[model samples]
Target chain A: MSDRMGEFDLIARYFTRPAKRAVLGVGDDCALLQPAPGMQMAISSDMLVEGRHFFAGVTPFTLGHKALAVNLSDLAACGATPTAFTLALALPRVDEAWLQGFSSGLWALADAHGCELIGGDTTQGPLNICITVFGEVPRGQALLRSGAQADDDIYISGTPGDARLALDALRGTLALPTELLAQARARLEQPSPRVALGQALRGIATAAIDISDGLAGDLGHVLEASGVGARIDPEIATNLIAGCAHAAAAAGLFPYEKLLEYVFAGGDDYELAFTAPPAARQAVDAASRKSQTQVTRIGSIEKAPGLRLVDAQGRSVTQTFQSFDHFA
Target chain B: MSDRMGEFDLIARYFTRPAKRAVLGVGDDCALLQPAPGMQMAISSDMLVEGRHFFAGVTPFTLGHKALAVNLSDLAACGATPTAFTLALALPRVDEAWLQGFSSGLWALADAHGCELIGGDTTQGPLNICITVFGEVPRGQALLRSGAQADDDIYISGTPGDARLALDALRGTLALPTELLAQARARLEQPSPRVALGQALRGIATAAIDISDGLAGDLGHVLEASGVGARIDPEIATNLIAGCAHAAAAAGLFPYEKLLEYVFAGGDDYELAFTAPPAARQAVDAASRKSQTQVTRIGSIEKAPGLRLVDAQGRSVTQTFQSFDHFA
Candidate 1:
């Protein structure tokens, strides 16, 4: 690659281009962009380390996509449309193959979402990827967790616990059917962000968040933000995990009442959990139909703070809330 | 510290705050921001890796400030007013003192520029800092290097070579006068970006770029972008270096053309270099007065496509055009 071109030449070759609505693109010292009219910019960042965020053996393509996807998930939770992004890649060396794959993966997503890759920096170090994404939402119309009110219906899109189970299967801690293994591996490799569902819920949903750090922990964020409580049906959460026997068996490893723990506390689901007012239920349904996104109402918001889980028999289920913790 | 909170809590403590024009800062999944009316958003990102951007022993405060400053320099080059930023920091371990100092230094510059720390992510790894800064300029008014025309007057802000001298002193390759040494150290620790000067050039400058990768290399960028050439006087560059020799001599370095090379090829000056039509020269001066910034006419754009350095006697000088190569 060095024989072909230098760093600046490489940047100009693959990264510099004008995008629709971009006031300024590459070649300038920085990019100047116009945010969508009447919209506020939604911004989020995520950093993936060599060992902490992914295995060292993971391809740069997956690494690049996942890095951007994680941050995009944040934008999706806020009902924002992806617009632009900056990347910071620290590498041990300039691996040509790695860069090609990484750039291709990043560009694929960027093009698909109409998000332009604007600015970035590259440096020498152990591999690390940091991506900051910008999105736009109508002013005063962002879906925030603070809007969840008592008695509002709580809904989640897509399946949870699968990604976590996939990780377990990868670690050889669990056995899975061949077809299930393929599905789990795919989920691990390329988790989808609920962008469409989030945008659909823009006006109708009272509050929303992406299930990143498991349902319980992420829901805790909503509870803290909205100053409310939630009583989720443990059976519903358990049944979600029971869809896969390997995950169900993994759940059996925990205490009897804690089978819902993985669904509630496991992270990296990248699914949206939202709250909608009783009056907007019809609108929410309409949005689900329009967006073709599944919306499952699993609980109701309460005036009291903290989370409670009830079994099918309506008995309180006591369980340990163990999920992904940054330090842990 | 881990005892206090997790990554999210740490972000809340250090990186979240209301910034100028920020509608919502740091609490939601993504920040909600508003750019100044009639202005476009200028965005830039820079990543600093340990042992690559700075020495491993450097203070976290200086590192943090430098990370933000480098990106702001890009905005300043574009004649944009710094508005907001997001930081991505990867560390091998949590060090509370380091975080405190780093955050304090970062906030110092942010507050001064009326920029808010809107969003960020923190994770574990070898120390890597990625900062994305936002600035605003009037619509269709961003200064671009591609706008430079042949026969345009070339100008730069402030002096060069100080940062290089400081780096030399820091590496023990040079000795300097005590006062000059302190000043050079300050240049390295808290390099001032010519934001006002860039903003002053908004309407007057035909083309512009920030002198981060030395005068020669960065000017080459403008030349290439504008499809023009430049003839810089070597004596003028040498004299500029001569003026800084007291510091260099005090730092125990030779007062020779090598010093000039650093000024011409050494990077990280964070000064603006721009071209302006003859008719706009007076207006440029008026803008300088209005913004309380100095504008130094350095050279002239030429019809040719290659860069040349000529002596007072009009003889071409042989000098290697070098700058900071990120990959190298």
Candidate 2:
């Protein structure tokens, strides 16, 4: 960096562009944006640390996508439409190759969702990525955490356990066949935010949250927020893993027991877990079809006090499960 | 960390509060907001890292204030009214004292500006605080960096060199009287953002920018964005230092030359540097008076190609500045 190595030139090279949707972009001290008229803006932020959130050997391309993806997942959980985001990145040095790969991945996903990059900060430090995303929902139309009612049908979108399996395989805690590991690894690094499904469920789902800190852990947030408990079917939870049904009868990736452990307790699956009244079942099915995403009915919200997983005979079998926590 | 020690509990302990202005706040996937009708939103992000941004021994309260203040300064430059913000923090461990101090500092400044913390994420990792702020400006009325014209009267808010002086004193590069050191240190740690001054200058000022990374370097951004240049009065620049006039005639903190060096090129002064056409001089003076901020005329924007500081005799004396670069 030189007296002549101006910050604007660096930002202009990597981050600046014509304001397509925003009123102003990176050259200004603050970016100017106008959310679509008469809409409420949905805002969320998430930070990714180099070591704790990802392996040091991870490429910038995947890291960039994952960072933005996680924030988008939060927006997805809110039943909000994605619009724009800002990235605050700390880097050890200016590596043009890294920036190139990172920006490529970032813009690709951003463009796909029509979510523009508005503004952010770049600083010198160890690698850390934080992104804050903004989306919009009609006023009072947002699906909230407190809306789940007693007897609401609890549903989850897509597969939820692949990412955890990939993490375990990478950590050497589990071994996987090459093909299965590649699939799981991709799932871990490039988990898609259920944006369309969330939008579809807006009117149907009573409450929703994206699964980040494991199914049981995230569902607990909904339970606490809605003042309701849930009874999940253990066999259904195990079957909810992607391709688990096929793998179980053929080349099982892990024992049924390990699969259940990863499915219910492993964190970082960017899928949506939602609650909708049973009366909206047809609407839920239509939303799933419209979004081309699968919706699985795994349980129901109850007026009882605590979350429980029931065996096939409806007996509680929650003894073996442990929820993931950030601190303990 | 155990299953009992979750991220949500920690968020509630420190940050979960009913958002008075936000449509939806913490505990949801995304906080919801609506800027006043027909207004454009101003967005900016800033990240502070341990060691690089602050000393490890720095008080959490001061660190929190500085972190949010810097981002607020960005909105000030754009003449936006502060609205709300989201924070993404990573911590080494939970220290309740640190959390209490940091939250108090953060809330104090935020409340003073009526900027609410709507939502954010907290994770266990090395300490890093990244905040993204949203503000609002009447549509099409925001101050822009690209509007400066040649020969516009250049002005700066308050004194710009105090923070750098405090930094030098703290680093043992310079010795200051005890009382002076305390004042300088406060300037270094709690540089108030010129939010009111910026908002006041919205229609009157031709271009504006917050001087954080030294006057010349940051003003360089305005010059580049507006496709203009500048000629500075060297003596005026040196005299712009806080308490310099009083200190110069007494036991000096350092040689006059060294003081000028810090005044001209030293960074972290959260002052506003802006330009107004000659026709708007009266309006500029009224704005300064209304905002209660000292606005000093330092130089003029030039049609010439690059920035130059001229001595009393009107020849170039800008050779000493090595404009700081984060990478360098």
Candidate 3:
């Protein structure tokens, strides 16, 4: 079925549709959408490169899913609901099987999330995927990093540093227990976007950001935005490390202090980290229960503006920080 | 500066802003935007590759401007008002001078058109640019290709085939008249998006699209969508073909019919082509008078579903049926 069509025909077959909630869709010069009542639209974009963002041998299906998933995670961080998306793909050459798998993966996520594919452009070049997602939130109601206030409690959903370990296993830098390796691979390939948790925190959380660049780096973003400081417990991070052989080896390579640094600085975790006032802790706890996600308190926002990692003895540890940098 | 700043800081320095109408712009997880009252938002995306879309040595400034310009032109085809844009760029490395020039060009256009830089992504890879633009139009009033009817007169704005000619000149395949070469280059590098013309046609034109892929190929899109055919005059197309020396040389390399073929099938004109009822002809004529641009009535819609081009002797020209195919 893929072999029978070219790019233009594929677009016309799969993407072109009349305006539904949209004022315009694929057929016209541009798509037109009407924002829902009393809501401002949230817009974000992300680009995935073949060698940089993912391994070259990974299936296009997983690539597509991960590409859109990362951008949707941004929407989740802002406490917005996904609405629509546009894709721009640059490929070295037309590969029917790759395109079929890619579209299938993209459509799956779009359908499940109720996000419509509205516009896209395909061209010949190195493999590159750029997606811009649109969502809706009530005006001025979006959660922002700058909203983190001094004395607010900082909490993170799910676990951290698992995706980084998965990458190590993939790179053959370490070995992993088979069962745990598979689970970590799945986490890396298809992350569960924290949309529900983000929406749940809209009214109660003081500030929030998705943990894409590991806990330490992303939390630093929140701290910088809010003009505050934080002192995180290293024991809690060490406990959160997944029990896999590769993780164990990677942990062995690092000193106890540096192991915690990996949890803080390694990236690709789509978990949400947020701050809330002390008064809202009970409500936050209840909301997390309702959302079926763990909300673990890690620290407190401080009046000063530097990040400190504290040992069990309550002494500051100095270590180099390493996080994913697009240009690096 | 480029080495010192990572992706986030670069975004903050260049893109973060609170524009006049934007509810939010840059810095956050997502940008928030509000559409004008009673107006539907129009959206379009285009991806430009370093080698395929433009020459390798093309300035970053022109590349940035052209990327946004082409998408904005799509909104113009829909008769919509410009509002906001998102950019997705992949690069091998961050070059400060390149980024500075690119951002300057993007911000210049955004400021001129009242479109804010709302959101986007940056990643590492071969150079590729994907830009999505948003605009607004009255509800249910967007210009559409499916709205053309039989017997409606077809009109095209500006001259055709210049960009293709300029491309040939740039590749050293053909020598162009010095005066014409500069004009052709300008047409290719800095396309004048038909925003005003589109706004003027909001109530009068039956159907419209921008002439990106020459006159004949794009008109065919309208014909196919509207379930109609067209009969265009070759003499009228010939009159619209500037840079005749290049055209004549190109004709020699290919065939005499090839000149007409390029005029009909060549793209990147970014001019408006629309079908208007005979009753609205006077209004179109009056509107055309306001600009130096000439609006030529070159064809009429037919009941059938194929395109035909007639010579001065009134014989159908088979070669003019050829059209540009992006994938082919």
Candidate achieving the largest DockQ? 3
Lowest lDDT block of 10, candidate 3 chain B = B241-250
Candidate 1 per-residue lDDT, tens place, A155-271, comes to 887777777777777789766777787786666667777787888889899999988888888888899999999988877656654434335555454453434655676678888
Question: Model 2: per-residue lDDT, tens digit, A1-328?
Answer: 3233334455767776677888887668999888888799999999998878899988888887898899999989988899889988888778888888888888878887889888888878888899999899988888888889999999988777778878888999777788878878887998888999999988899999999988887888899999999998978866654543225323655566766767777778899999999999999999999999988999999999678889789787744656665566
**Model-by-model lDDT, in order?**
0.79, 0.84, 0.80
Off by over 4 Å in 2: A1-9, A244-253, B1-6, B244-250
> What tens digits encode model 3's per-residue C-alpha lDDT throughout A1-328?
4443555786876555554555556667887789887888988988888878899989888887898899899998999998888888887776778887888888888777888888888777888888989888888889988998888988888767667778887999767678778987877887777888888888999899998877878888899988999877766656754433226545465456545654676578788989999899999998798788877887788888888878679887786686677865
Candidates 2 and 3 compared by DockQ, better number: 3
> In candidate 1, what are the lDDT values of residues B56-159, reduced to their tens digit?
89887887778888888898888899888888888777778888889888988877788888878787778888888988999988888899898898887766
DockQ of 2: 0.64
By descending lDDT, how would the candidates be arranged? Answer: 2, 3, 1
lDDT of 2 by residue, B8-31 (tens): 677887887888988877778999
Error of 3 at B104 (Å): 3.0
* Interface RMSD, prediction 2: 2.7
Error of 2 at A248 (Å): 6.2
Order of candidates by TM-score, top first? 2, 1, 3
Q: Considering only chain A, what is the TM-score of each predicted structure?
A: 0.92, 0.95, 0.92
lDDT of 1 at B258: 75
